[model samples]
Target: MTAETQAAPVVSYGRLVPVVVHFDDLDALGLLHNARYPVMVERAWTALWHERGFGFDGDWEAAGDFCNAVKELRIGYEAPVNRPGAYAVHLWLERLGNTGLTYGFRFCSADGAMTYAHGTRVLVRLDAATLRPTPWSEPFRAVGRELLRRAS
Candidate 1:
C-alpha cells in the first residue's frame, strides 16, 4: 500500500475508540490506575470487532460461538492523565497468524498530542464451549489482513 492509503493513526486504524475518563478510573495518584490500561485496551478491541459486524454487538452466530483469548500482552507506560476528560484508544492489526492475531495499540490524547501508553496483544481464537484454540475463519483472517495492509 502507498503512504496515502496506509492507515492514519487518527483515522484508518482498525478503529479509533473514544474513551471518556470517569472519576472512578482515576487512582489516588490522580492518574489512571495501571490496571485500567488493560481494561481500556480490551474495550477498544471489542469495539473494533463490533464495529466490523462480527462480534457480540453483531451476528454472534456468524462468529461461530468463538471467543478471543489473550495469549500475551506487553505494555509500555509513557505519561499519565492528570485530568479526567476525553482520550482515545487506537487499535490496529499488527500480525496475523494461524489461530491467532497480534494487535498493536496506543492510548493517546484526543488531539494526538501525547501518547500515554502503548501495547501489543496476542489473541488466540477459541471455541467458546470447548475453550480450545481454533484457527480463525476466512472472514476474520481477511479482516485482519486488510487492517494490517492499511496500517502498513
Candidate 2:
C-alpha cells in the first residue's frame, strides 16, 4: 500500500490487520505485558506507510526523504485475552501540522464484540541524509490530511 497506489476508503491509513496474541505474548499475570502494545502499534504503522507508498526500502530512502515518527503513544488496555484472538486494528490519523502528524488506532475484536486497545502516534518528516526535521510537501501533506480526515 504505497503512494503509487491510491488509497481506498478501506485503507485510509494503509491497512487493517488482525493480531492474534500467542501464548508467548503473555506475562506471569496472564494479561498481555505492557511492552507488547508498542510492538502492536508498530506493526500497524509499518503497514500503513507501505500501503500508502512511503515505505523505507533502500530505493525509496535513497530517492527521497521520509517521515521518522517520534510517537507519543497512549494505549488503554481493555479486556484481558491471555489467549488473544484475531483482534482487528482499525487505523486512522488525527491531524497533520507543519512539523508533525498524529495517527490513531483502535484495536478491537474482529467481530466488533469488544475493544482490546486504543491509541495514537506522532510522526515527523526528516531529511534523508541529515535525518533532520523537514516540511512535508503539498502532495504528501494532501495524502496525509485526506487519510486523517476520513478516519477522524
Candidate 3:
C-alpha cells in the first residue's frame, strides 16, 4: 500500500510512558534539540523496561532478555517541542519476529493531542554470550504482546 493509503497503527494507551524534557535538552532557539528526541525516547523505554523488571544487574547469564540492541531507528518530526515540560512517549509493538521486533512510537503532548514526532525502532535480541542475534524468550514475547498493536 502507498504511504498515504496505509492505515495508521492503533495506539495502546496502556503503553504510554510519561517523559520530561529537561532544560538541557533544549537548544539555543529554546526548542528541543533534534538529537535529544531519540535520547528521550530511549530514557522512556528504559524506564518502562526497568519497571517491568528487565535490566542488567551485573550478571551476564541473567541478562539475556535485556540483551536486545537497536538495529535501526527512523523518526519524523511533526512539530518542535517549544518548552521544557511534561510530555509523553506512546509506544506499541508494530512487528514481532523471532529475533527482533519493531516498535512504533510518538512523542506527543501530555494529553496526546499534539504529536511532536513519531517513529519506529527496530531491535534485535542477542545471545548473552555470543552477542549475536537470538530468538526472544517466551516471557519477553509475552510482555511485548501486551503492547502489540491490534491488526486492522
Candidate 4:
C-alpha cells in the first residue's frame, strides 16, 4: 500500500507521512536496505504534494511542462531499520529558489524511539519536453514559501 497521509495534531519540525515497510524492503541482513531510503523519501515527497492539492492530473504541456525532478539527494543512515511495520517520514520545505526547491527529511521508527535516517533533496522545476530547468510558477513558489515558513 502507498504511504498514508495524516493531519498532524501539532506541527513540529515538518510534515509527517506514514510509511509502510514491505517484506521485500529488507536486506539479506534482515534490516532495511540502505538503497531503499531514497525510494521511501520519494514516496513521502509525492504524498506531500498531493496533500497540498497539487494538480498532477492535468496535461503537462498546459502546465508549462513543469514537473518536479530531483536535482540532488543526500541521505545519511544513522541506524538500522529491522522490523517491517508502520513508520513515519517527516518532510519539510527548506528553501525555494528561482529554479529549484529544497526539502529536508527524516525517517523515524513507528514508536518514535529511533531515527533511522535523515537527508535533504533538491528538486528543480523542469520543462519535460526539453528536459531543461525552468523557473517555478508564482503559485508554486507561493506554496513553497508558505511551507518553508511553517517549517521554520
Each model's total of backbone clashes: 0, 8, 0, 0
Question: Cα lDDT of all candidates, in order?
Answer: 0.75, 0.66, 0.82, 0.76
Task: List pairs with backbone clashes in candidate 1.
Answer: none
Off by over 4 Å in 2: 1-15, 58-66, 137-139, 149-152
Q: Candidate 4, which segments miss by more than 4 Å at Cα?
A: 1-9, 55-66, 111-113, 149-152
Model 1 stretches with alpha carbons more than 4 Å out: 1-14, 57-66, 149-152
User: What's the lDDT of the predicted structure labeled candidate 1?
Assistant: 0.75
- Candidate 1: 10-residue stretch with minimal lDDT: 1-10
Alpha-carbon runs more than 4 Å astray in model 3: 1-14
Instruction: Write model 1 residue lDDT over 66-105, tens digit each, in one string.
Output: 4777889999999987777777787778888888888888
Compare candidates 2 and 3 on TM-score and give the better one: 3
Q: lDDT for model 4, please.
A: 0.76
TM-score result, candidate 1: 0.81
Give per-residue CA lDDT, model 3, range 58-118, as digits (tens): 7877887778789999999999998988887888889989999999899987666789999
TM-score of each: 0.81, 0.73, 0.87, 0.83
lDDT of 3: 0.82
For lDDT, the strongest prediction is 3
Task: State in Å the error of residue 52, model 1.
Answer: 0.9
Q: Write the per-residue lDDT of candidate 2 for residues 36-107, one digit (tens) a residue.
A: 876876776666656577656655455342546585777788766666545556676688888678877776
lDDT of 2: 0.66
